[model samples]
Target: MDTPTEVLHRVFGYDSFRAGQQEIIEHVVAGGDALVLMPTGGGKSLCYQIPALVRPGVGVVVSPLIALMQDQVDALTALGVRAGFLNSTQDFAERQQVESAFLAGELDLLYLAPERLRVEATVRLLAKGEISVFAIDEAHCVSQWGHDFRPDYLALSELRELWPEVPRIALTATATPATHAEISSRLGLDGARHFVASFDRPNIQYRIAPKSEPKRQLLEFLRTEHQGDAGIVYCMSRASVEKIAAFLVDNGVDAVPYHAGLDSRTRAAHQAQFLREEGLVVVATIAFGMGIDKPDVRFVAHLDLPKSVEGYYQETGRAGRDGLPATAWMAYGLQDVVQQRKLLTEGDEAHRRRQALHLDAMLALCETVGCRRVMLLDYFGQQGSEPCGNCDTCQAPPESWDGTVPAQKVLSAVLRLKRERRQKFGVGQIVDILLGKQTAKVLQHGHESLTVFGVGTELGNAEWHGVVRQLLAQGLLAVEADYGALVLTDASGDVLRGQRQVPLRRDAPRPLRAKTAAAAKSRPAAELPQEAAPVFERLRAWRAATAKEQGVPAYVIFHDSTLREIATLAPSTLEELATVNGVGENKLAKYGEQVLEALTA
Candidate 1:
């Protein structure tokens, strides 16, 4: 039998394993259960794939998405590993052929949707096959508190009940300590050996700017730094998705829209285009990117605030999967906080409280005056990470000032309106009242007569907006769910009573032109030396044609990183090309001659 290292090189074309992989692979190959928490691009798949190859029988993998399963199987098949998947997208004949292959021990890996385990026929089919390992991809979905929870995953514990002796490995790209514990408890892998990799992705630069003209801001961001790059733009609503997509397209970006409101066929087509094409941007809601396997997504921009930090991390982690430089940029403001808080006010008290905790953490991350990466890692219970120099905070630190007077003025306006006038007003009226604006609404409502009117004349309109946003983030100000009117929380009373102080973050003024970061100015992952650039482009052209003929994404044929290495090395023969990091024996045998010709041409 081939050892794990042998399988890794012979099939997957890697000389060594990444951190925490070799031990986990050997443990599972020795028939031990494991729960792995690795980052998105940290190679979690190899932990199971290598063990499956080294072990005796077919590996059964439980995946959550049909696209993910198909992508995995295609990539595996390209590596000469016999891989297949059964999902709703497959017709009966196709499913039967895959099932027959599994039964006859001709397949190394077989991917199944979590929902498929509910079928009696699938259970019988699994029983009939000689199984090696059971791998659960995206195991965080089993947690009720997780961002991407799937009810079908709760039934996965039965895998242990049905096959007690077969080894199982559960893996995910994002999870908090609490969610990690829940996954273990719910999946009945309480005693499984746990592997927690570092949650940091240094290749992704995190930046958040105050929202002004958000659509224009997004366009400027794209045109300035990320022009013609493949990316995903996340919006909070379907209307925003459509508008943003149209706006981008009008501004000469190759863009598409995806949302749950769209029909399944349209969504599938858009997703396929995103996977298959280059330099195309997709504007979407959170529904768009859960199991996306695209490796070269250069950035993930959020036009609205994410409900939680986990969601933000997972979405941004999609970029730079090839270990290249990428950006995680967001345009956040007071309305985002108001909308998210209003959302949290629904459901029962317990659910509301849970959601409030999530929102509070998210707000803290946004409002923090310190390092963004430090707070992000700290949230996942991984500590001792210094301030990473890659985020907005570390690059240009925001100032924290004593905003007690400003906080008092804002709260006093809300207080007097509620107590004296029996009225509540939204941010616009509150800002106007503070700035002493005698606009039509203020004059009509007689808010100009309030004592707090004109109290905030020392600060400009934008600075006052910053004050209100920070107040809302600190929970001293709350938004009424129905009308988005500013209301005082219990914490507001302490600030007004002089019993507490408010230290607010003073954001740097938005520059006329955004100064691109040093990291953003670096070359992309696929970039090569001047002499090798033409060779890389030729090889890419060949890969595009081959993948088009096969009806698979270009990365499934050969990742850009592999092509770059090949272009630099300029190997002449299959034996020499096989030594490249991503050139497995199967790939070298299939495409080596063509690659050599591309090099010469």
Candidate 2:
């Protein structure tokens, strides 16, 4: 049996395990259960893949997404692992072949969707086979409260009951304390050893801007920050996904949309192109991005507010997976909060309250004046060190000014309008009254003779909006169910009485500094030296052609990161090339000669 370290290099082509990976692997290899909470691109796959390889029988991996299973099998096969997947996508004949292989014990890992496990036949087949560990990927899907809940995943807990002897490992890329606890309980892994890695992705620069003409802002950001790079643009709705995708394509960008509304074939084709092609942008809804394993995603831009900080982190974590410099940019505003609130109103009271809390956490992250990384990490029950210099706040610290007076004025306007005038208005109306705008609604409400009237004229409409958002985020204000009127919460009285001081981030779009811009434009290290550039391109061309011929994503042949390593090292012999990270035994054996020939050519 290959030790975990030996398998790490010989199969996965890594010199060492990432933090917490080795320990988790060892625990699983020793037939112990584990629950791993690592960030996206944090090598969560290896914790199971390696253990599966070292263990005796095939590791049964339960993934939630069919697309994910296909990609996982393809990548693992490329690494010389006998991996196969049985999902709805396969034909009857294909399914038979995989089943035969499984029964014959010719497979090391088998990826199955949770729905497949519900079938009695499938469960009985596994019972007859010599099973190894049971690995559940995206374990958070078991949490009914999570953003990406799948009913199919709920059926997975049966595995623990059916095969209690087989060790189980549940893994997820993002989970909060509550969600973490729920995952453990739901997956029947409550007693499993827990390994929680740092939630920070330091390579991803986090930036959130107040939404104003979001399309225009997104276009400018793409042109300036991510030109000729592969990325994802997340929109709140399918309509916006289609519109933005069309707009991007019209502007000479290679972009496509992916949403739940689209047919599965269309979604699959678009996703395949995104994985195989370089510099393609997929404008998508939250329906996308659960099991994406792309390593070189340069950025993830959110065109609207995510439901929660966990959702936001998972979506943005898709970028910089290769441990390269990347970006997490978002555009949000008061409207996002209102829209989310309206959405929650449709659910049951308990569900609505839970969603409201999640939204509040997300809003607080956006409205915070401090470091975004720190705020984001803190939400996930992790303590962050000094401000991460990679985020927008750390890059160009937002101007913070005393917002106490403005907050008081905003809250006073809300309270007076509700109590004395017997009127409840939206945030816009409140801001209009505060900014002294004598709009028709304000005029109809009678002369603005209130003490707070015109008192906030020192701030413009936009500035006042910022103050209101901050107050809402800080719990100083709340939106009453009565016509969505802003109401003063108990916390508001402290600020109104001068007992609390509010600090608001006066956020403005700071032009990308030349240094930052250059860093943003920096390519993978393999493309840096002039000599290696041509070689890197050559290797990419070869990989692309091979992938096209094989009908698999190019990354399956060799990830860009791996090709870059090969290019930089310029290994002239097969033996020398084998030493490059990501050059696993199977890939090296299959492509070593061709790789060396490309370098010489």
Candidate 3:
């Protein structure tokens, strides 16, 4: 077996391992197990990948996603390592080739779904051959409490008994205490060497707004902040996906919709196009985006709240995967909460409880006032050393106020309007009633005649919108019962009678409109990225093809930036590649000719 450093250079390109990586890889290489908790883009794949190479025989990787598996394999093959996978997506000939490779001892890494691992053919192959290690990516799926639980994942426990001598490593981008314990128990990896990397993503900004003319808000965000970055817009339903995708297209944005409802070919086409196309925003439901392989997603905008915090974190984490700046923007209202609740109620009892817990976590994220990055870090039990200055609150401190009076005014109006019209009023009409907006509807109702009508006039329309959005976000408004109307929550009722005071981010615009394109240009143009630019993309495509042949994540072949370096320098020999950042001796010795052939040719 090669030294860990040699494995780093030969099979994977890295100058030296990141903190704790070599140690973790050594533990597994020595036949001990490991459980890895690393955030998105934190190099989690290397822990198992390196060990898989140094160990005695074929390394088996269990991944939950087809695209994830495909991308990984493409990246590995690019590095000239023999990698393969057997999944539902594979044709019979492809599956047979993987088996042939495994038997011939030609494959270094073999990717499989948990279900495939349980098959008789796979078990027989395992029994007949030397198995080196088991690497489980997205390990959280093994836990029942995990946000994305799969029945097949529970069967992975059999691997511990089936191949007790083979070391096991479970990896995921997210986990909490309950999930961690569950993962340990489920995978039988208790007391395994555990490596927890920093979960902080300083590149992502967080912002939450109420769901009012939410389309206009999303458009303004797309036009003003991030005009050319890849992004995902998540909705709760396929219908919503289609509608929003169509809307964005109407507004002159390059957009597409993806969900289970669409034909599989159509879905695949849309996905491939999104990956290859830049500045493309995909409107999708939960049915899409898992196991997605596209890096460089610039933002994740939620037209509705996600079902749970873990779910939200995973979805939003898709953004800024390359560590460039990105935003996580959420627009939600009372209707969203009600819809989620109604969906949960339709499921089994255990599912309902899980959904409730998930919804509660999402609610906390929506209303939190502390540093969002800090809050997110703490959520994963990570103690960030400093606040991330990239988020909204860090960008512009929110203006606060007692808001006790305005809160009372808004709630009292809801109560009175409920008593009088026996109808819940949408926030705009309710606000107009309060501001005494003289409209035909106002005259027909004579709503300006009420005491609460003009009390809120002192609060600009935007400030009032913020108040109501906060209320809806906090569960103080129920929209379904009101039929898209906003009514006071039970908490709102208590506050209306002066039983409680609402602390509000009291200064928001009266209303949002098509924002004027005002560019406050940066003082100095930022220099190009650390890696060579332009040609870097060609390097990535080359790496992707190589990794595909080897069946490993693209980073195993070389990171995008490292490839960029090769592109810039046209590294023609092992010596040249070693000089590139992250290019270690092990990688040069193994793949030097392959890289030189590509570049020098």
Candidate 4:
């Protein structure tokens, strides 16, 4: 029998497992249960995929998303792997064919949803026969306090009771401290090996900007910064998704929208267009994208803020999945805070606590000025040695000023209005009230002459607005849940009275798309140039091909950076290529001739 390493190349195209992938897979192949916390783009799928093909019996993958199941099965089928999915999307006839295949041992793996696994008949079938492993994807949803909680997932622990000796593995892209604990207990992991991979992907640059003419800013980014690439734009509301997609199309982008409001056929069509075409920007609400597996997404733009940092990380990690350079762009503001807070307060108390934690993490992402990559990794329990130089802050650092005076004005305005402590205030009215505009509220309240009024004229409108968001995020400012009015919390007194130097980054928004932004709409969005991209890819294929011939990691044959440089240079001889930076002494001496031959071939 061929070893697991041999099956990695024979059944799958990969030469070897990634950093921590082999360890996790070996444990599973040894018939041990595992709970994994791997970051997006960290090759979590491979941990179970290889072992499923190598070990005995069929592997049962219980996934939460139907769209993800379809895409994953399609990819596996394309690779000639005996894989299929059983979901609501399939017809009865198709379901019967898959069931027959599963019983006949014609399939190596099958994807099922939580609903399927919880059925009495499904449990009986599994108990009657031998199964390799019960892999639970998106396991964090089982945690009631998790950001992506689902009531159905709460019963997932029964998998342990049903198949205590069958071996199990749970995986997710993001998990906080509380969520991690809950997953272990909820999954019934009495003593399982915890395999947590580093979340840091230094190639993707992280950025945040205040909300301002979001469509225009998105246009500018598409035109100049990320022109002619694949990307996803997330909005808070379905209307915003439609409007943003329409605006992009009208302005010159071949953009599309996806939301639950859209029919299944339309959503599938749009998703297919994005996966096949180049430069197709998908404008979607949080509900639209879950397990989208398009690898060369050059950027991800959030027109509105996400509910939590876990959501943000999962969304942004979709970019640069192919280990290439990418951007994470977001336009956030005080309104997002109000909207998300409303979402939180309207839910049950359990949901509210999780929502608050999610909000705090999002605020941290917005306010962080150090290494964007480092901060994001730190949230996922990964550490980075250096800040990636590509992020907005690391690239062009923002300048901040002491915001004590602005905080004082914001606090005073909420108090002088005789407002209940929870109402939301728009920037215009907030500014007008602070400057004693006497527009109606000021005249009615007789507060035009109050010391707090007009004292904040020193700071511009934009600066004051930024101060409001910072204070709101810091928990010093609150909006009444019943009335949607602004109020000061008990923590406000310290910040208002010069007792705190409020840390604020330069109040910036995503740059506007240039006039040339529409030109890329004329071409394919996903396909890159055939010469260099294909050549670089060939070098990668050759590395994978050659690595399998020898038993070593592909990096041992040629690093991706080296192959990329070789594809660009395409040197005919060893002497001319010595100048390439990635082609150092050892690499130049070792794989130089073979790489040159492949390039020339």
Candidate 5:
């Protein structure tokens, strides 16, 4: 029998385990239960996969996304692993074949959706076969308070009840301390050993820009920083997804729209295209990207704000999964704050409170003047991290000035409007009043004569809007649920009096589009030596054709990282090619000669 390290190199083409992987694998192989909190792209799959291969029976994987099961199986199959999935998408005959393989002990791993376990037939089917281990991927979904809660995951605790002897491992890419505890409790893994990996992804540079013609800003960001790269653009609404996708396509980008609103077939086709093709961008709502295994996504841009810091981290974590430099960018503004606040009003008191806490944490991250990475890590209960010079704040530190006077000016304007005029207004009117703009709305209200009007002319219209946004973020200003008009919070009293000093972050002038630290560290083929570029392109072309022929993603044949190593080494023999990191035995024996021919030609 092959050992785990040997199996790692022979099948998956890695020379050694990533940090914290070896110990976890050893324990699971020894029949111990574990809960793993590793970040995305941290080789969480290998922790369970190697143990499954070395153990006696098929590993039963409980996955959340049935739609992605085929791609997952395809990826493993390319490595010469006998992998099969039983999901609703498969026909009865297809399910029967996988079942037979499982029963015959011919399959290495069998993937199933969590809901499938509720079926009595599926339970009986599992009872008929031996299970080496149970891996619950995306285990954070079991947390009722988490961003992506799936009711089906709550039933996963029964796995331990049914198969008391089969060791289980639950894995997730994002979880806070609270969510971690909840996962343990809900999944009945409280006694299971826990391994929490560092949540930092230094390859991703975090950036948040104040929204200014956001679609245009997104387009400029794409064209300038991430041209000809695979990316995901997240929007809060389906309409925004469609409009942004169309806008990008119109502006000479190869982009597609993905949301729950699309038909299943259309969504699948778009997802397949994104995985198979290069330089494609998918503009999607939050529904699109939970289990995406694509590793080359260079950037994740948010056109609107995410509700929670955990959700934001989870979404941005999807980028730079290959450990190459990538970007986590967002366009945030006053309306995003208001919209999210309004959303919190729905649901029960407990639900509203939980969502409010989430929103508050997210707002704090957006408004933070320190390192975005540090704030992100702190939210996940990791501390003592020095400034990561890759985030926008660290790269270009913003000035924080005493905004107490400006705060008073803005608050006075709102106060006067309410107490004197018995009227309320949203941000636009408030900013106009602050700037002393004699717009029709102001004149119709009959008087630019308020004491606070024109007091804020020391700042530009944009600057006044920034003050309002910051005040809202700081909780001194609240949005009325009925009409989103500015209302004062209990915290507003201190600033209204002279008792509080409000220090606010000044929005820096937009910098020139130049190579950021993250961009400079990127190792794309474009950065390869001049001679190797063409060879890399040739290999990419060959791989594309082969993937099309085999009906699988190009990465399944070989990752771009592996090909880059091959292009750099210019290996002349199969022996030399096998030395590459991702060149496994199966791939070497299958495509070794063709790779050499492609390199030489």
Candidate 6:
């Protein structure tokens, strides 16, 4: 029997285990349950993969997405580990073959969707076999309060009842304290040992700019900071995705659109291209980028605000998986906050408050004057100190001004409208009244007579918008669900009566060209050295060809980081090449000669 360390170094090719990984593996290998919370690129897979290999029998992994399962199987196969998956994509014959392999003890790992466990035949088959352990990936999906809730995952709790002795491991990249508690209870792993790692992705530089011509801002970000690099441009709607994809293509970027609206064939084809090719952009909606195994995404740009901080963290975590520098950029404004409030308002009353809280947390992160990383980590219940130098705030701290007067004006307007007119007004009407714009609504509502009218005329529309947003984030303002009207909260009274002060981030005027140029200078170039350029390209060509022949993503063959290391090191023999970070025993044995030849050429 191979030991866990032997399997880690030999099969996965890592010299040492990451923090919290070996302990989890040891706990599970000893037939104990565990719940692991690690960041996206923090090597969560090793925690379960090593235990599965070291334990007695075959490991069954419950994954959510078909694409994710296929990618896992391909990567495991590349490591010379016998792995198979059964999904809707497979025919009966293929399914039967995998089942036979499992029954005959010829497979090391088998991947299945959570829904498959509900079938009597599948459950019986698993009961008939000797199973080492059960691993639930994306375990946060089991929590209804989680951003990505999967109904099928709720059925997974039955596993504890069915196989009481088999150890189980639940792993996720994003989970709050509440989310952690819910996952443990729902999955029947409340007594399991809990392992929570730091949620900070220091490699990703967090940037949030006010949304002014968002498409233009996104294009500037891409052109200046990430030219010729692989990235994901996320839009809130499918129409926006289509428009942006076309616009990028027209502007000389090789890009594709992906969303649930597209047919399966088209989505799969576009996903394949994005996975197999280099320097391609995937313009997608929230429907995409869950468990996408691509390791070298250079950036994740949000054209709109994500609904929650959990969603934003998970999406941005997709980039910089190779532990290299990456960027997380977003352009959001007041409209996003309003739209998200509307969503929460229309949701079920049971979940409405929780959803609103999540949105507020997201807004706080965006409007925060402190380090973005600190705010983000704090949301997940992790204490973060020392402003990370990678984020936009740390790089160029935003100036803060005493916003007490602005807060008074906004709150007084809300009060006067409610007390005198007996009506609630949305942000647009409030803005109009503040600016003394006697429009049709203003005239109809007789808001011109209000004492707060024109009190904020000195500030521009954008500045007032900023004030309103900051107020909401600070809990001084609340949005009425039914009419999207802004209302003053109990906390607003203090600010209105001069008992409290509000400090808001001052929106400084920045020249587009100068800002873009500075950002471009800040970003590192994604290029190989002059002398190693030829070898890198050749290695990439070889990877592309090999992936095409095997019908898998190129990254599954070898990550770009590994290829660059090979090109730079110019390893003349298999033994020297084995020292590379990604060169595990199986990979070295399988591709050693070919890698050496490529380096030579």
TM-score of each: 0.97, 0.94, 0.83, 0.84, 0.97, 0.94
- List residue ranges in candidate 1 displaced over 4 A: 510-522, 525-527
Candidate ranking (lDDT, best to worst): 5, 1, 6, 2, 3, 4
Q: Which scores higher on TM-score, 1 or 4?
A: 1
Better candidate number, 3 or 5, judged by TM-score: 5
> Per-residue lDDT tens digits of candidate 3, residues 377-475?
777887755767666555555566677787788778888888987867677787898787988988888787887878777878766777766666556
Q: lDDT of each prediction vs. the true structure?
A: 0.90, 0.85, 0.75, 0.75, 0.91, 0.87
Backbone collision count in every prediction? 0, 0, 26, 18, 0, 0
Clashes of 3: 26
| Model 4 C-alpha lDDT per residue in residues 324-380, reported as the tens digit of each score | 767788988877876666566767786678678878888877877776777787776
Off by over 4 Å in 6: 438-447, 480-483, 508-530
Local error of candidate 3 at 188, Å?
A: 2.6
- Stretches of candidate 3 above 4 Å error? 209-220, 223-225, 247-254, 276-280, 331-350, 413-455, 460-462, 479-497, 507-526, 529-559, 567-574, 582-601
- Model 1, 1-601: lDDT tens digits are 9999998899878899999999999999999999999999899989999989999999999998886677778889999999999999999999999999999999999999999999999999999988899999999899867888899999999999999989999999999998999999999988999999999999888899999999999998988788778999999999999999999999999999999999988998899899988889999999988878899899999999998888899999999999988889999998898899889889999889878888999999999999999999999989999999878888888889999999999999999999989999999899999999999999999998999999999998888888888898889999999999999998988999999999999886544345453434345533678888778878889998988898888898888899889988989888889999988889888888888888888
TM-score: model 3 vs. ground truth? 0.83
Best by lDDT: 5
> Which is superior by TM-score, 1 or 2?
1
Output candidate 2 Cα RMSD: 2.3
Ranking by TM-score: 1, 5, 2, 6, 4, 3
Looking at model 3, report the run of 10 residues with the lowest lDDT sum.
Answer: 519-528
